[model samples]
Target: MSIVAFDLSRRLVAEALGTAILVATVVGSGIMADRLSEDAAVSLLGNTLPTGAILVVLITILGPISGAHFNPAVTLVFALRRDIEVNAALAYIAAQVAGGIAGTFLAHAMFDLPILQLSATARTGTGQWIAEAVAAFGLVFAILAGLRFRPDATPWLVGLYITAAYWFTASTSFANPAVAIARAFSNTFAGIRPVDLPGFIAAELFGALLAVAFAGWLLAEPKPPTTFKAAE
Candidate 1:
């Protein structure tokens, strides 16, 4: 169906469900990885692979329905670009956050863990903040650039970028505000402390704004002639 044909309710459902599944995969994989491996590196590899793969799958499947943002940072960027209405962006953010919470609970249920708990994983400090900023910048830049020049490849590009960022960045590229918030509820390998969220969220927003600014300049259309003659 065309975008216009899908009503707001349908789009909101799609966003919520997609974000829920994405977060579930992230949290679930982290739990499973931790259980299955003693080596920290190996557990991280397991978590990274599944999270990236699920992102590719989810974006490819849900993109046509809801644009498959699944992240408040992404939704905010689109709202700033006027690609979506402000109210719709707010609704989307709400759905994403709620879905993320549900996903964490679902993962906990599947893993037979506590359904509600605060993470004590302290992922803060200047190095971590800088890493988050850099990670968010690269993620948004790749997305905007891919959409401009290679729209069909955007899902894969994003997945690959996140997979790489998981290894390269200190924060493991939590680049999403919704995901960061939800992760705070779980005290697992993938969790971030609730207190550490502001820095990561701020870094993410700053990076997204930078990407938007850069994309506007890089993708602007050529100017038309200013000295046009009057028609006869």
Candidate 2:
């Protein structure tokens, strides 16, 4: 057998690659927004819409290959739901963090930003915290519901939800840990404050855990004879 067989190691590598792609798109879009727009809200949406589109496309393309986690929050949810094992979840998280940093650095190089001027972990006060919680809860809830009723629709629905959340939430709905980490690299409008990383992560984790507990009850499996097949 090949040394890197179809196993956790390969899956971890795929997570790394997926996370890297995610961050590249995220930060690159931020660079584009900064270069192109002066209106912060418009700039935020400009970056977010495309980021959502890319996320859906990438997740659809890479979900089977690596589960397309790209986020520790998602990985942890999957693990809690028994969709992935512990070791694999840990590996996925590690890859995600590494890939996020790599993607930030790549964006730094691409935009010719100062080495330390990249975005940081986004955070907000109480109102924004509530917004983040709601956004994250909505995302995980939608994912679980899709998995239960329409597995084939998961990617697209997720993308749409994220896109909407970006506009709706006060904090612009940064629901993923890896995405937050990657955002830390850009000093553009999308940038988060490094000092606020802990709060953002805590809010996200709270949302995730809350979603996990409720997801099982909220999302029951589809009725018999309606088993979901993979998307085409």
Candidate 3:
């Protein structure tokens, strides 16, 4: 089906649903992992796998509809690039944020945990800030490069990159502002305190923008190979 097959409302629904599922996978798996394993490493691995696997599935299925951008930082990049209109980007961000929060609540309900809770898990300091920046940078960079060189493999590229980022980044790769905000509502393994939201969000946005700028240059077609004439 053509991308235009869906209307704006339908596309919005797709975006919301995709983001919800992604968040649910992240939040729910984190909760389950934490409960099932006493080893923090084992729990983190469990959480990491589901999050990465779900991203590949979600993006492949939902991408044709809404480009499968479940993160506000991503939407911001597209908006800056004029790939998506400002108004639509705003709407997408709204849907993403709303859907993310709902996903957190859904996970809570599924786990029979308290519905209302705020994360007290502090994720702060310059290290975390830099880590967040690096995480977002890598995430956006992967998407940009994958789209440029291999659109068909973009989903896997993103999934694999994020999986690596989860282990490599100090902040556990909360590269998405929406995901971070949603995670804040659940004080489980994936949670980040609301107070830390600003720094992470800022770092993520900054990193995303940097990726766009760098990709613009990096992905450019090499200028036609030209050779200077030898002097007589």
Candidate 4:
């Protein structure tokens, strides 16, 4: 039905569960892809497809419940837009972060790797930071434009955009802060160094805010012209 049909608790649960599964998909697929391929490109393709596919599925199924935010940057955008209440937005962010960490652990457990580990994969430099910003800008723009133009197609739009962004972006488009934070716990192909986290998160947030500003002007509907009635 509608997003408002669900209560805050249910919405939060969906957000948590959806984010958990999303992080699991990213981490688990990266591990599997790395194991299966010697070619970095092949492994990345392997990593990208499952993530794109799962987004389509997860957003389709969960969009009605929590609007399928799954990302703190996205939640913040909505909070800024006043689409969701401030307190609820905070709760949603907390749930997403918690779920994302849990998802990292879940992937580790499934792969029989150590659950508690810090990522040492160094993802830094100006190009990488700029790439993360661009990636997040594309993501938030995609979501907003999709909602404005073709609400029914948002799931596919997001999935396909991310699929392409993963290849194009130097950082492979870890556009979600929660996802970035979670990935920092796993030293895998999808992972980023814990030390690299602040830059990525900051870039992601800045990009998301930019999208909101741009979309607010770009996607907004024109107001009806004011008419003065003839003097009676």
User: Model 3, 1-232: lDDT tens per residue?
Assistant: 0134667798789888988999999999999999999999999999999999999999999999988999999989988878888998899899999999999999999999998789999999999999999999889989989988898999999899999999999989989999999999999888899999999999999999889899999998889988999999
Tens digit of lDDT per residue, candidate 2, span 70-173?
88988899888777879888888999999887877787788877756644444668987888788888888888778777888888888899989988988888
Candidate 1: how many backbone clashes?
Answer: 0
Q: Which candidate is the best by lDDT?
A: 4
lDDT by residue for model 1 over 1-232, one digit each (tens)? 1133568898999889988998999999999999999999999999999999988998888888888889888888788878888999899999999999999999999999999989999999998988888888888888888888898898999899999999999889989999999999999988999999999999998888888888889887779879978999
Candidate 1 stretches with Cα past 4 Å from truth are 1-4, 223-232
What's the true lDDT of residue 210 in model 1?
88
Question: How far does residue 112 in candidate 4 sit from its true spot (Å)?
Answer: 1.0
Q: How many clashes does the backbone of model 2 have?
A: 6
Q: Which ten residues in a row have the lowest lDDT in candidate 2?
A: 1-10
C-alpha RMSD of each candidate structure in angstroms: 2.8, 7.3, 2.3, 1.9
Superpose all Cα atoms of candidate 1 onto the true structure and report the RMSD in Å to 1 decimal: 2.8
Q: What overall lDDT goes with each candidate model?
A: 0.89, 0.79, 0.91, 0.93
Q: Compared with the true structure, what per-residue lDDT tens digits does model 4 show for residues 139-193?
A: 9999999888898999999999999999999999999999999999999888899
- What CA RMSD would candidate 2 show? 7.3
